[model samples]
Target chain A: MIDKQVRTVAEALEGLQDGAAIMISGFGEAGVPAELIDGVVAQGACDLTIISNNAGTGDVGIAALIGAGRVRKVICSYPRMVGSRHFEERYRAGELELELVPQGNLAARIQAAGSGLGAIFTPTGYGTKLAEGKETREIDGRQYVLEYPIQADVALVKAYKADRWGNLVYRKAARNFGPIMAMAGKTTIVQVEDIDPLGTLDPETVVTPGIFVDRIVRIADAGKAAA
Target chain B: MSAADTIQRLDKQQLARRVARDIPEGAYVNLGIGLPTQVANYLDTAGDYFLHSENGILGMGPAPDEDHIDWDLINAGKQPVTLLNGGCFFHHGDSFSMMRGGHIDICVMGAYQVSTRGDLANWHTGDPDAIPAVGGAMDLAIGAKQVFVMMNLLTKTGESKLVEHCTYPLTGLGCVSRIYSELGVIDLGPDGAKVVEMVDNLTLEHLREMTGVDLTMAQ
Candidate 1:
């Protein structure tokens, strides 16, 4: 049988090692794979480079991984929020590194990595200090800065549902970066709420095809856990 | 000091209305956090306008009542908001593509300081102790068709925010075109910052003296 389903979070994150670049999909707490993140924490992978939208909030989820001294750097758009004191304190103290990419550029760069593109010219950071060291070109009088792809060794994504074939469906706006991350990562692990039988998921509704997915771990009592 | 000096300047709501007046009809706009977000509430009702929130929301409506609040449906600033009739949600990547692809007509943003030459310095205050959060300000600054800064003319410490040169790290250069402040509204052009309007209570001299930048009164 061709099953992408993994028995536990450990099996889903088997090859994640030290110094690996991990892309986590989320917009705040919306699409984060908590069980996969917890597996990373339990595995104690160090010197990790985390890529996401915002730095994890509070001492849970991403913050817990950072708090445990696992993450050495973070590449994100917004790294500071209400419960992001862990990142703030460490960053201010020079204990952690942060690369702040604009939201658009961040997404485009990740997409470029997945699509086998080298670099993209974006007008987002043109004529700014962020563009200072970057190569820029004027296209018909408008300037565009070159941004390179942001690839990852592993991607941890959360999906609303998945099939035995690993076709994924996302819930509402929580879908955020899950699809893109799945594409950009060398190994993609998905934590899903429900696993439908093979051929049950509609082809049009499948946000992420099983081809991109390496493992699917179903969190027990997903309804209660998500609540 | 005259009693006129005691009169309060434009509050958050008044300043928002002033900024809203300049937005043309049939436009797609993105409003930044804080003061800029307020501008949406005062937009002209007749226009077929669409609001884009970077957190996967497009065609955003006014803030929802407390009873109807949905935490899942929130704006870029993470505040609960209602979706308009035509509103739809998409992935974050698509939301940003709309922002950075020049689809947005205007972006009204809150700034710490804006230079006479339209240089913006809002993401960071240059304070070492402050936690830096760049967010989507950089993309909005350079990608929108026109960038409008909505902020207080002076900082809380009585320092002018409209300066000849910005001291803080810039979000973008030569991006800002118009400025809406409590003291007055100004247009940033090749010549410099020109005072387009002033509160009736304040004089040109008072504005000049406070700003320290040469302010040409619009004819």
Candidate 2:
């Protein structure tokens, strides 16, 4: 049986070590794998490097992880939000490091890693401070900055549903970053609301194929908890 | 009458409506957070305009009522929004591709400063105490086909935001195509800033003095 289903968040988070580069899939609060992140906190892995679109808001998910002093650095497009006091405090106190990339570049870099590309030339961030140290080239009369791939040791994803074989589908705008993070992570662990039986999910609608996902754990009440 | 007393400036809603009127029909638009988001309310609902939120929604609708709010379905600003009919969602990679790939027609954004050459400065003020968060500003600045900026012509201290050159960090070089401000609408090109229209009682000479940049009447 090719079952990727795990019984608990702890089982899904196994082998996550200190200093691991983990991608937390989300855009702000939506699509964030809060249960998995809470599991990571309980698992006691420190010095983690987190990659996401936003640092986190309020005292939950990434913000809680950062507040716990478990993260050493964050590589994201936007690390500041209304309730992101935890990240701000650590950054100002010199406890956490930040690598800010343009939003498009951030998505492209992760996609490049997943797609197994060497590098990409993008118009975003060209002729700006974000591209200050990056290489530049003119392509067909347009300037582009060279951006490299961003890989991760682990990816924590939240999905609406998944099959036993790990085929995943997401809901609405909450789908952001889940598919690409699934591909880029060496070990992608997903927290889903429901795990359907094998062959129940139509292959045509599968957003993240089972090949990219390593572990699946169903947090049955996650949808209600997040609400 | 004093110069201040004689001048007329558009309120935020009026400026938003003014900017909204210029959006072409059937265009795909991205409204940046803050002042630019207000333009959505002023857009012609009868027109076939698709609102793109960088958070992976297309055909995005206005803010949902409190009873229908869903936390998962939100805009880039993290505000609750409704998805219109034919709306769809995708992952971040595809969402940004639509922006950076030149598929979006227009993007309205708020800016701190704009130069005569259409240079944009809004992401960072270089304040040591301020936490710099670029978000998708740089991408939207350079990605959209037509970058329309909405801002006040002058700061509260009376400093001109339309300047000879931007003193703050540049978001993108010469990416802004037009600007809609409280004082008037202006277009930028190789010839420099051209005044499209001004509020009632606002003279070109006075507007020039207020902007601190050379302005020509649009042909």
Candidate 3:
């Protein structure tokens, strides 16, 4: 059995270099690996390509990374949030690049990458500006646009629970993209609230198995002792 | 009174009520952000309907009490909401699959303009001044089995949102099936814009004059 447990955030993020393509899992504030991201910020890597659903809001999550000038480009569904001034300023000044993908297409592309498929045809984004410069075909009298896979060198994921083997179980809505990001990353590091004992989590309830996860770190609990 | 007179329009809650009355029982619905989110507060809980949020929530309920609000639980708009008894949450990818796989029965969204031929433009005005945030609008427009648009009939400058052709960038071509405005609701059928119903104190001719598009009253 592989022992993927690591003592701290730094050890989980070993070999992370500049200009790496990374997937930071989250939907708004939910499911964000804050400790791992803090490690990346502390490491001060630059010119990274980050993919997620939103471009981070306020001083939390990906906004902190953007504030550190770490992200050169962001491929996401929603780049503009209510108080996301960092990305807005950078984008307006042409200092940053944005790929505004439709939400469903974004997921399918990432899934295709993990499944070892070269590309996929999606009915979403057809006959819109998003379809521009992409190959489109009509299958069964319906229009579909061809989208490529989105693979990442590193993925920072968050989960509620993990056993010694790195199998994961998520907490409610916080499971947004962690499972899929685990599948698409070459190095999948997950931060969990608790590291359950071996066989503590039911086999059927495991959202992401141990094979997809590379390392596991237990984040310090806020206002309480670490689990 | 001349056509230039200030015609009273339905407020946000009233427009939401209008949209709520049209939802059928046992239908799985997706509500877009902004004004469309208000429709949830008006839905009859006695009916069997489920709300889907693109942010990975199904069976989404109305805004929760401030005391009971959970930060980890939110809708696509990032606002705190309640989850009904049958509510379940999943990954964002699976949420989009439910949206794109034609599992949604209806999707109600806000729009900048909707053409008579059922073309929709909501994401961007194509103006250099605006920031483009498309979100999940494109998926909802084409992927939902039926598309419903809810917005003012005219802009703040009084230009008709129901137009001969949309001036803004199209969100989806010929995807809108129904439009709900403050003044009236019109169906974009194969024939043309058919008037379904109207607010009190408005006429078919007035709606026609206001919209600048030919309006046929539905039988």
Which CAPRI quality tier does the interface of model 1 achieve? medium
DockQ of 3: 0.59
C-alpha lDDT score of every prediction, in listed order: 0.87, 0.91, 0.87
TM-score of each: 0.92, 0.98, 0.95
Tens-digit lDDT string for candidate 3 (A129-182): 888988999999999999999999998999989998989998777888899889
lDDT of 3 by residue, B147-206 (tens): 999999988887899987888888888889999989988999667889998877788888
DockQ of each: 0.53, 0.75, 0.59
DockQ for candidate 1, C-alpha atoms: 0.53
For model 3 the interface RMSD, in Å, equals 2.7
Q: What lDDT would candidate 1 get against the real structure? A: 0.87
lDDT of 2 by residue, A29-61 (tens): 889998999999899999999999999888888
Residue A91 CA error for candidate 2 (Å)? 0.4
Quality of model 2 by C-alpha lDDT: 0.91
What TM-score did chain B of candidate 1 earn? 0.92
Model 1 stretches with alpha carbons more than 4 Å out = A220-227, B2-8, B44-48, B65-69
| True C-alpha contacts between chains kept, each model in order | 0.64, 0.86, 0.65
Worst lDDT run of 10 residues, candidate 2 chain A, spans A218-227
